[model samples]
Target: MSGDARGLWVTFEGGDGSGKTTQAELLRAWCEDEGHRVVRTREPGGTDVGQTIRELVLHHRGDIGPRAEALLFAADRSHHVAALVAPALARGEVVIQDRYLDSSVAYQGAARSLGAEEVRELSLWATGGALPDVTVLLDLDPVAARARLDADDKPFDRLEAEKSDFHARVRDAYLALADADPERFLVLDATASAEDLAARIRERVAPLL
Candidate 1:
């Protein structure tokens, strides 16, 4: 690990059932094995306050206005960065996160028909412009992702329950984000074997450590 005062921040982004959690855990274990302190967390529920917001946004029975949903996610990001992420990095601990502003931009901005730039700006403002050192994007077809979700036999969350078209738009938005920031993004095929994906992610993150 580098003896630098600041630590690395790594985030994973993808649609439902894209295997982001699996990759994140693999990276976490790898970092720990390298003798680096690691902090594994996720947006919308990384902190105690964020847990309440996560439930309301992800599991609420009724509909939530698109703008309201964006705001709620931003609020969670604000608190999560302040109370958890930033502090972890300051302590020189690697932060492995499940999602970040990219999800808000993809889900609430482009997919919901709101302006992508607008939602991105709101998230940047909320987090005081925090960004991950590396972002691994598991690109997968919406239909395939849906099939995987269905196989789990678990109830879908509000976002996961969205129509196919919605998920397609989210996928496009994520790709666009990656295109705009190629340096920070490692876009990989979600259909690849878990070990292969983990190896690629490790390759990208090893230089930072």
Candidate 2:
């Protein structure tokens, strides 16, 4: 995706409570320290339209059908890339995003049994095949991840409140994605120290910068 673009796009992916937000913030700060302009954002809530979709897809009280959920996420992704990510890259600003197509592939696709390749293709079409220069996958055990969330004492969102098996499927799907595209993915152990993970992420991203 960065082949013709002047800027780099880096996306973070993982299950809920995998410390994706924390690592994304660390990378954002490091990029600023290195004198790079950074555009930090997240999927489903990256824009006004996305924020509404995020609420519907993630926090709504009732159930959303699998295909409907996938389409909602795709809608958010389409607008997010067009209105935010693409513009930032055009201006030569590093875009650090939390989650992306990978989340949709893992959650709505694998966990929801909607088929990974199908979900991926939908996202690709939605974003006009836009992809990140680098993707960081923070792999973590679902049990451990759940423990982290429980410790936080926050109410679980719709996806986060799913059964353990569902989350396990999401993790497996993520690992498969990393394995399939090792070049674009930096798979890190979410169990590692935050500082250690940050350093490893920087090492992977420095060359791209």
Candidate 3:
């Protein structure tokens, strides 16, 4: 691992059921295997405070306005960074995170028709401009992703239950974000085998370690 006092931070992002969690776990395990301290977490629920917010944002059966939804996610992120993310990094542990700031940018800003830049700016401000060293984006077809989610026999969360059109917009927004920051993102096709995707991600991360 690099000798920097702060640990390397990596984020996994994608649309619903696009395998962000799977990829994040793989990276976490790999970092552990390599003898680096690994701290694994996910946005919207990375901290105890974030858990309450996560339930409200993702499962509450009510209409949340676009602006309100965006702010809720940002609020969770702010708490997450202060309570979990920043401390882990300061300890020099590799922080593997699922669904970071880009998620709010894609889901709320793009999919919900709020301005993408404004939402991103809100997140940046919340985190004091903290960005992952690498962002792995799993690009999957919305239909196929939905099918994968269905096979799990788990009820979809509010975002997952959204119409395919909304998911498509979220997908496009993620791709755009990756394209705009090619140096910081590794965009991968989600249809690839999980093993293959994990290997590719590990390969990309090896240099940093």
Query: Tens digit of lDDT per residue, candidate 1, span 1-209?
Result: 12333999999999999999999999999999999999999988999999999999999999899999999999999999989988899998999999999999999999998899999999999987888899999999999999999999999999999999999999999999999999999999999999999999999999987
Q: What TM value does model 1 have?
A: 0.97
Question: Candidate 3, which segments miss by more than 4 Å at Cα?
Answer: 1-5
By summed lDDT, which 10 consecutive residues of candidate 2 come out lowest?
1-10
For residue 185, model 1's alpha carbon misses the true position, in angstroms, by: 0.3
RMSD of 1: 2.1
Q: Candidate 3 clashing pairs?
A: none
The segments of candidate 2 whose C-alpha lies over 4 angstroms from its true place after superposition are: none
Top-down lDDT ranking: 2, 1, 3
Cα lDDT of all candidates, in order? 0.94, 0.96, 0.90
RMSD of 3: 1.9
User: Lowest-scoring 10 consecutive residues by lDDT in candidate 3?
Assistant: 1-10
Across residues 1-209, which tens digit of lDDT does each residue of candidate 2 receive?
55879999999999999999999999999999999999999998999999999999989999799999999999999999999999999999999999999999999899999999999999999999999999999999999999999999999999999999999999999999999998899999999999999999999999888
Q: Is candidate 2 or candidate 3 better by TM-score?
A: 2
Query: What's the ranking of the predictions by TM-score, best on top?
Result: 2, 1, 3
